[model samples]
Target: MTIQAAFTLIINTLGPLQGNREAANIAHIVIEHITGMGRMDRVIYKDKLLSPAQEEQLQQALNALLKHEPVQYVTGKAWFYGLEFTVNRNVLIPRPETEELVEWIVKDTHTPVKILDIGTGSGAIPIALKKDLPAATVWSVDVSAGALEVASQNATQLNLNVHFEQIDILDTTATHSLPLFDIIVSNPPYICESEQKDMEEQVIAYEPRIALFVPDNDALLFYRQIGLLAKEKLVPGGLLYFEINEAFGKEVVALLEKQGFKNVILKQDLYTKDRMVRGEN
Candidate 1:
């Protein structure tokens, strides 16, 4: 099959499910990853024929997309904060909004500081911070050993030194012995279970639920626990950053304040959603 033919097939198959623009983007990404052809190559070689193996691979990727699988998971890779990281069903795919959280942390501190990321998932936040702040000592904690494994691999592949630990922050006893940090950041599971119906099928069905959701009655479960832990773990006048549920920004800010954190502030993402909160110890 010709490159254009395969491309058209991919669009026709996934366009209705993912919308035309996104389907086209996923098609290009799949093609680029598989063939390793640059964007210009897709334009110049539109009519070029794909070998039998290339056609088969493209078809397989298209099949996954047709099932509403995220392209990042289908390709086993995700881009975040100007770097690529490996991803799978075990980890939540990194989002652009989280990049804003990382950027905020990077901009807030200039000198060497100890940093810890709660519910690290794919290790995107810590890895990006370490890359930009090489002198910072970064540590990441997650409950799932599988997720920690993926995060650890990403740290190694990115050549960023970050310590990974499997610990459930919800169990305060588990984190009692962990060392204090200069800055603590988390993009924890803030999505309430009731909100799952409103999410994309691809995310709810494929992404790791433990990393994406909280009980409706306890929407701030992770944030609440992390906030408490930060109270004990942060140095005097240290910083706490959270990529919060937009709906609960004020609540999260309040939670931190109640924990004795001061200078609490809420910030919006590029989309202008109240998606981040910061506080000082």
Candidate 2:
């Protein structure tokens, strides 16, 4: 099949399921990943025929897309903070809001300081921070071995020298072993179980639940635990940053304040919804 034929097949197959714009996006992502054809190349070589192996790959990708898997997961790649990352079912795909959270850290932080990332789902946060703040030392921890494996590979591939370890942030004993840090950031599990009904089908079905959902009753579980940990592990003026659920902006600010963190601020993302919160120890 020609390149245009393949594109049409994918777009037509997914249009009804995901809508026209999204279907076009998925087609572009899968085609570029498999054939390495950029937008111009796709247009320039619209008549170029796909080789047998390429056709097979496209077929497989189309099958997955039909199931409503995210294009990032289907491609095994995602872009975050201008860096490309390897993603899988084991790791959550990095989101634009999370990138905003990272940018906030880049702006507020100036000195080279030790940083700890509570959940290392694709190593996107720490790796991007390390790239922007090249002098800073970064360590990231996660409870899932599979997620750590993916994160470690990303760190090695990017040559960023990030420390990836399997540490459950929920475990006080394990967390105590971590050294003090000047900045601690997390995009931890903030989606409440009760909110699952409202989330996208692809996210609910394909993304790792352990990295996304919190018990409805204890929606601030990670913020509370990580905040307390920060109190113990952060330096006198160290900062704690979190990508939070918009619904709990005031609640998170309050939790940080009650934990004795000062200068607590709830910031919104590009959409102007409360998406990030910062506190100083």
Return the top candidate by lDDT: 2
The lDDT values for all models are 0.91, 0.94
The C-alpha stretches of model 2 lying farther than 4 A from their native spots are none
Which segments of candidate 1 are over 4 A away from where they belong? none
Give a tens-digit lDDT track for model 1, residues 125-223: 999999999999999999999999999999989889999999988887899879989999999988888898789998999999998888999898888
lDDT of 1 at 88: 94
Clashing pairs in 1: none
Question: What is the C-alpha lDDT profile of model 2 across 55-133, one tens digit per residue?
Answer: 9999999888878789899889999999999999999999898999989999998889999998989999999999999
Best by TM-score: 2
Residue 210 C-alpha lDDT in model 1: 91
